[model samples]
Target: MSADIKAWYLSKTVWGGVLAIIASIANIAGFGISGAEQAELADGITALLAAAGGIVAVAGRLVAHRKLK
Candidate 1:
């Protein structure tokens, strides 16, 4: 695999984003998702994605800062 694809697979944040997208697709397609509990799961996944985004942003800034130093 290319370095780019390998880096993507190695990133926890990217994995979280991918999972979030998949979960949304499943919810949209109404595949085995029903009632409040399942809906709550979606909400949790969204929150998880938010957290992963924050982590990625902070890490990116750190890398940029170090590179520019």
Candidate 2:
């Protein structure tokens, strides 16, 4: 694949993974529940943030790529 594609893939994968881990850790630490409730809320918030981050990242990448093109 081209460098641009590779870079995009890397950015999305790496940053997405990082954000997910962070959110998970934050939820685990932020709310000290150890059962279903904890998992539910933490996973919910983390998924939400991860989705938002992915959207922003993709949009930014598209804009930057457009500019480069």
Model 2 compared with the native: what TM-score? 0.41
Per-residue C-alpha lDDT of model 2 across residues 9-38, encoded as one tens digit per residue:
345445455556666787788844334554
Best by lDDT: 1
User: Candidate 2: worst 10 consecutive residues by lDDT?
Assistant: 6-15
Q: List the residue pairs that clash in candidate 1.
A: none
lDDT at 41, model 1: 58
Shift of residue 55 alpha carbon in model 1, Å: 0.1
lDDT digits (tens) for residues 1-69 of candidate 1: 575564344455555566667667887888643445455655676667668877998889988846653
Total residue pair clashes for candidate 2:
0
Root-mean-square deviation of every model: 9.2, 8.1
Off by over 4 Å in 2: 1-34, 65-69
